[model samples]
Target: MKDQITIVGNIGSDPELRRLADGTPIASFRIASHERRYDQKTSSWVDGTPSWYDVSAFRSLGEHVLASVKRGQRVIVTGALTIRRWENGERSGTAAEIEATAVGHELRFGTTVYTASAPRREEPAPPPADAPDPEPVAAGAWAAPGAETPF
Candidate 1:
């Protein structure tokens, strides 16, 4: 997989939390972003592309998003694009969605979220206190970012 993605927009709506038939928790929300263009004549703000995306987060991630994220809050979404189709008797429409893996408050955009009540991700148990540290390795032994390993 390429792991290719686009990101970082403000939330357009409140995240709605719900469950599936199998009882997995999930939340859905929308993020709206504006695209701008340079106008040589007016040299002013010109509205370009306005995109709205439907985002879904699962399990504890979903709950955290619902509890911490709010309308007009900025967020960065990273997930592969998915197309969902639904029907209701005589009408149907397709949805473009992103299954969010990570989300963060856009502090740069004046959105602040205190995650005191949000569920934290479970961390792996640390090694026993008696364990010794491994010797440090030389540089260039690990693969660079986005580069394949020699092994």
Candidate 2:
């Protein structure tokens, strides 16, 4: 089973958008998620250590994220989680990353206006230059053969 996680946090950096040689877009950003505990003695909320995660979104989702997300914005991200250990010149650390499946603003922080993207439609191929034009039909001639037109 794939490991998945959902996190609500503030974006730690601006989303970086890049295109691969194949023209596929990918966006990456950092998010800081932390816990807040209410202390009755202090009568206030105390913040815990922040956990950072790198987030990546691909294709149209990446494009949308590049257009919509910004640094310091509160957002919710859900995706597959991956942890990798890397070493460079004796320095080694585990990095956490998420391949985002869904991303959106955290509504509790503020209101956001949503705009739906229009479906992409491929243009019809042009007719061949040597192709003969079909004969024109009279108005209301769309009725099937032997069927009477309602108009």
Clashes per prediction?
A: 0, 0
Residues 33-75, model 2: lDDT tens digits: 9999999999999999999999999998999999998999999
lDDT by residue for model 1 (22-68), tens: 99999999987677678889988797676778888999889889888
**Candidate models: Cα lDDT each:** 0.79, 0.93
Best by the lDDT measure: 2
Question: How well does candidate 1 match the true structure in TM-score terms?
Answer: 0.63
Instruction: Score candidate 2 by TM-score against the native.
Output: 0.79
lDDT of 1 at 141: 61
What's the lDDT for candidate 2? 0.93
